[model samples]
Target: MPIQQSGKRLRVPWLRKLDENDLPVTLPVFMAYCMVAGSLRSWNRIGTKTIVTLVTGDDFYYPVFAEAARFFARQIWDGQSFHGNVLQWSDKNFRHEAEALRDERAILFAPLSYQIQDDDRLLSDAVVPLGPRTIRHAEAALRRARLPITGESVELLMTEPWSRLSRAFQDRRDPLQAIQRLRSLPKAIPPAEPEAASPPSTLGLTLSDTHGFGSGLIEWGHDLAKDIADYKAAIIPWRDVENGVLISGPPGVGKTMFASILANTCKIPIIYGSASRWQEAGALDEHLKAIRASFEEAIEKAPSILFIDEIDVFGSRGETDRNSAYMRAVITALLQLLDGFERREGVVVVGACNQPDLLDSAITRPGRLDRHIAVPLPDAEARRSILKHHSGVTLCSADYKVYEMATEGMTGADIERLVRDARRSARRQSERLNGDHIIRHLRPLIKLPKAYVHALAVHEAGHALVSHEVGYAHVADITISRWRVEGDYRALGCVEYDVAADRPRTRSFFENAIAVCVAGIAAEIEVFGSFSQGAAGDDAADLNRATELATAMERAFGMGHTLAVEKFSPDAFARMRASDPELRREIHNVLATELERARSIIRMQRDAHEALVTRLVDADQISGMEVDEIIRKHRRPTVSLAKPERRVAT
Candidate 1:
């Protein structure tokens, strides 16, 4: 029967013709077969068989089929011969033939398992066209028309296709019904696993293995699926372009891993390695040999990705000078290789660097690694997903409570390490992998001391307290305990501060500069009666910033009266170097005065300072309420500014 097209699906005939010209016989034979199939009689057992001459051993391959092939067989039964049935010619060249003859009658036959003679012309032929479904279903339809599985030809069904079709067909009560049932079956499901550790095949072998073919690694991200989609989208436009991408980010944030994931999404063969190791040898011969071999092996398959990780290890130097010959040679050869790579379809060069600033500048000039992106620290939601993914298939926990607890402020590497540690803890106790076990193990890692903890709370609270009290900056979570560290000193005491609305650290803020800088120190001094190094690092940074702001206020913005002249301090350090011997005394006195004023404000509101610190220390970490309570208790008379109108009325 004519293979009628109805949208994407095609109506199957009892048999499919192997050669094109057999349409003469095939057309009638298929019409009869369709009549039978369409009839109320039996759909099975109606196919015909006849003398199939063994022109050569290959002729026997024209096996019986269920739907399409059976129709063709029935047509041939009426003294019809077709060409392109893999006729083993005398020349022993087993190739597709353009034409075939049947019984002295000129009948055109396409080669069995044929190649299109001219793809353009064949595709343009309006008389016969195949949809993707019809063509892909062609073989299976032909298989159904063949002899039953119990027949002698069952040995031929042992092939992978045969096995697959057999498993699919074995369940059908009728061969005709099998076709419908088979197509209706769902696509095979992959094993459901939360975390799958790649095997030793992953060692030195950076390419991915998607089932059988080598591919790229899956990337790590907070939004794995979305970022993967974005990475894929970013590459879509450049797929045909002869350029590369430089995936850069902080260390342990998965640049190399992202490179692989991008390659995988591209559905191309990927070969990956680090440039740092290759350049160490300092010889071009070995380095270039490896790169050459990698390219040759990869190029045999046209669509491929070459991934070089830690590319900044080339060390920001002139190609001919500090860099090894191998470094220069690798970069040069890569340029040459990339320049010529586009001749092969679907090939790309992808690289990653932790420090783009450390890379030789030329590596990023357009053609080499053009798209620079940072795979930053995962946000809270991302952190949860990553933690869950790493946690394993069974998420016995109600929510991502433990994941959130364990992964705060952690990079992808740090998160993975925590998960591994959690799993290790579970393994040690032989306990069921669940949130309790994860939490119990993680609890000790994040615990810290009382005074130190209170100090942290007070310090951050001081920043937030003064900022909020003065209407300067916002603070998010003021944390006291080390929620993500192991010991007392290494404990993280932090105030996740908000971005200032007006970018207040500018030079013009110097009139109140010392106030902001010394607020934490002042708060520390007010609460504890003595200051420590808990906020010292911040102090130094703040001090330098304050001084710079002070100079800017005095000189640039004319906001300071102390300068009293137009001269700018040529060099800040030089001014210090050349200052009058007693300038140090005045400097200390000025800093002390600013700090004292900020602290005096705090001392008057001692209850507020204590309230904030005590609440944070007790809760270890508190949110908005801690902020509000501190503000409520810290009310004091400040000569600096008058109370608002409502407060005055109250």
Candidate 2:
């Protein structure tokens, strides 16, 4: 026994010293006992009767009932006098319950959960809350007691996730989980900044041996290290109080890396999962049970991070604990855990997901996820740096020149695959990876049959030649095939037209685009004695635009093209093209009229071009070396310079 405390301002007495086990087995059940007796006076009853002292064993039934009896005894019950008798325990106690129930004397209060097997010893007078597994037994017991229970009487309260968390899991024993989670002690604020950090000289880049999430990691150390320093200030105290963060992004972006780095930045342990995965548990209402355990552990661990990926999975529409209950139950549980989390603890909850729209409105409604940051796909600059990171210094050396030019439209995943595939190609060929490594890698993969490649190359060359010659688009390069990466739809045998996307498309520009679109089919037909419909996507897209231009030419410009006197309608071109096949033919004619004339000129040069291709392909690896050999033997240097860029444009 400890001595009572005494203070000058107030006297504090240490009364009866009781162990926690001395408390009732379940406090809520005891509370329910009080509520039923107190509430019985107010409930609408058949007769004016009052409930006073009702009990099963030695325990007192209604402590709160004493107050209700004094206040509402005369007002609500009107003319009743209630007994405070503890009847002897026997089979007839139920008869006493029946007599009271008939006149509706006392209200029955049921426990929130129970096992049917253990509840067999319970008297008939007792009411028990019915769950899915226990409802049949409860109903049977109600019949045996001769008590009339309403359909609504078997109401089940939602098993809250917080309900299962034990009051006991104060501090865990494991040290590894302790350090990794940065979880410890009782709300201690981190040390001051000047004293906290290791000296600046030692905080430089250190190699990491640990891997995460099986995805490729982006080293945003240079960019995000500064953000990390900022986060440490806003975060550490909140981490002491346990805060959460929302990281939003599209798929395959570096959001996961951002999360992993943030964990390392916070120097805390992180347990990552979807809300649903953590909610559902086994025979124990596993999810809710596990949630309770996890939260308790997190609190004990203190400075910990619970990373719930795909948060919107919880906050969707009409969530409840009934049928289709798993989603709703999980959401409800998460909300409870997140409730009242303020002023920063030593724990943090971080969530990430791609579909922000799918999340419940409650999540973003202030206070919940206070911060949302977008992690977009890497732009051209990020892509270049990513390439430099993946490629060794020797591969990126000045003489190598592989990454000298901007890699226009590659993803982080794409760049990773590019470096890996290129290295494999270099190994297979027994050649060192150098500037030409990518060019050779592109060869075996980006293949068409030799004749097809030649014709397609000519087709691409013609589009490039005419588009530049007609001053429609400046050609970037006339490559025989697209970049060597998989799933890339850039183009096969492409001539990239450099367009500033922010600028709007103009009239003469449309004319140049149409010419280039048609030149491929025109060149293929002229060289191979027929045309393949390989340019369908190009032709379809161009024809739709051509009709719009044709309509504008006639209606707006009044150039006597199609409908000479009318104002333009959005569907007018569509209706005309649908009504007359010749209209589509003529619209095609209007777009490609000049390009057809240019294709005839390329056809005249095809024989000489075939000689150039044969010489290049036979050499297996074409360069300026093969091009010069062909030019020296075939015609003259004149043929070499006959390309549209080298020639005088008319």
Candidate 3:
């Protein structure tokens, strides 16, 4: 093979010789190359194929291919005749060069982002996808290039070479443009001044001031904070206490804020980290080092909160993909750092994520982030309270009721954003923050057609009437929005019910639950000619709930024909439903049976249903007490709405 450059003879003035420990390549980029080194070395040892494909996500990393090739030529091939180059799609001779590489022992950097045929000889099972680079890599690049590390310099690192100082390096044909535009920036940034003292009441952000339920985490934090402050070690030892919890929820539900509140309440320092942050340290060993450092720091500052956001990034050891090897090693190191030989007595770890199921089971096992709590979207009452806090002004009860209805299905963060945007709007107009200001952000409510409002009322009335009649659950209130709030339609209609926690998950119990779920569909058919698409929509839509419960009865709860239970997860159950015709039929049968049952219940209570619908249409909302009175006034003597039980053949 003809060598393009002899490593021993090729000398350059701009670049210096790198020592064994020195890495001229960015850590992440270097780590990527190191990933494929083993396979290449294995081939070298066996004297088999020598052409290896390095797949990259973009051309931004193209500049580093030469530095890597040069470094590896000396380090791995030991200055032996070596040739390496990127087979870019942009090159006119891409096909010719690719064909030429077939007879040569070389490393080819190829961009997979470009369209390429799979049958191409250069595409192989040994393809290595380029690893990602973060701001951490940018910092490392600066140090390697012997440039001053400043905020402005780091910004330049992220810019395209042609747009900045990198063009100078490119003009000189120098590929290592790690310095970027640093030469134009000040060598150092000046120190910042300290802030003024805050009021005693404003010690820090508190859970007390925050809205929405914490699923008992907030209460637990308060208790722990009190005990720690009082030094009640005898009454509640650290060993005996539940030290950690994993919180999961959709974004803006305050997973990160939960940690902040815990730190504030406990009056302890909070150390933040994530798997991505740890992995940014570079390879598996570097990731392990970062993980250990985080834990060690938390331990040093005892009685602290170590919040690991996006802990799901560690993934599970059960994964069988290529990155599984790295995942297993990182997860194992994390486990050790979390609960190893060294006693971490005073530090409490909290893990937060948007998806809890994606987390490694070991990470959430008994001794670590054991307790899992999912933060739900704020309900009406929660929405009201959240508005009050963010609005920073007292409003009449009626105003709050309107605000709550407008903001339904919104998370805490969503509500906060609404309020912030409303205030900004108000400021722009130089007017006082009023209902008009908030309404502007939410957009003016568009009144639904009279016929549609009447239908919605009847549908919601069905839920309340059936729920109250069943006596299995307590109907709190029922509401139907006369106008649809722009951008958000979830608050169109709702029936609030309180079911006892002790209620058994028996066949009869689930049947009644399913009946409540489908009552709207049944009610619409009874009152109107037919039901509309209103019953089937969002995940929380009535029809969806009925279908899920019906499916679970047969497939999961073992309440149907067979006692044999099949384990169910949201995804797994969905796949089963999609693939299995018999299972889908069974689920449909359950729904049909329950739908009929709901229709029968509603048919018997027609007078009460009419009265409820009249009240709902007139008021657009009604209390449970009013519904109870209406039901009592119109009840027939022979009617029974209690949960039905199966009877033996007589």
Per lDDT, the best of the predicted structures is 3
Q: Worst lDDT window (10 residues) for model 2?
A: 161-170
- Relative to the true structure, how large is the alpha-carbon lDDT of every model? 0.48, 0.45, 0.67
Task: State residue 4's C-alpha deviation in candidate 1, in Å.
Answer: 99
Model 1 CA deviation exceeding 4 Å by range: 1-245, 248-251, 284-303, 318-350, 360-371, 377-384, 391-443, 446-452, 469-472, 482-484, 488-491, 500-505, 509-518, 537-597, 600-611, 614-650
Better of 2 and 3 by lDDT: 3
Clashing pairs in 3: none
Which digits, one per residue and each the tens of the lDDT, describe model 2 over residues 366-411? 5566556656556645655565566552444543333422343434
Q: Lowest lDDT 10-mer window, candidate 1?
A: 56-65
Which residue segments of model 3 deviate by more than 4 Å?
Answer: 1-203, 213-215, 230-237, 279-283, 315-328, 357-361, 376-402, 419-439, 468-471, 639-643, 646-650
TM per candidate comes to 0.48, 0.34, 0.65
lDDT of 1 by residue, 1-650 (tens): 89964332113443434444443222212322343232212112222221121121221121112233344334433334433232222211212223322222111112233433454233221112111122223343344454233432332222223212432342112343343333333222222333233211222322232111111223322223343344456744434454466766655565555555555555555676556445322235656766676667667864566777667655543534322554566667766766544343345666776557657767777766666666666666666656666675344445465556555555665666667777778888898677766566553444455656767777766766666655544567676555444432333665665655655344323435456666777887777787776443321345554555444454445444454444353234225424544545545555676677677667777777778877777787777656866676666655542112222232
Q: Model 2 lDDT vs. the true structure?
A: 0.45
**Better structure of 1 and 3 per TM-score:** 3
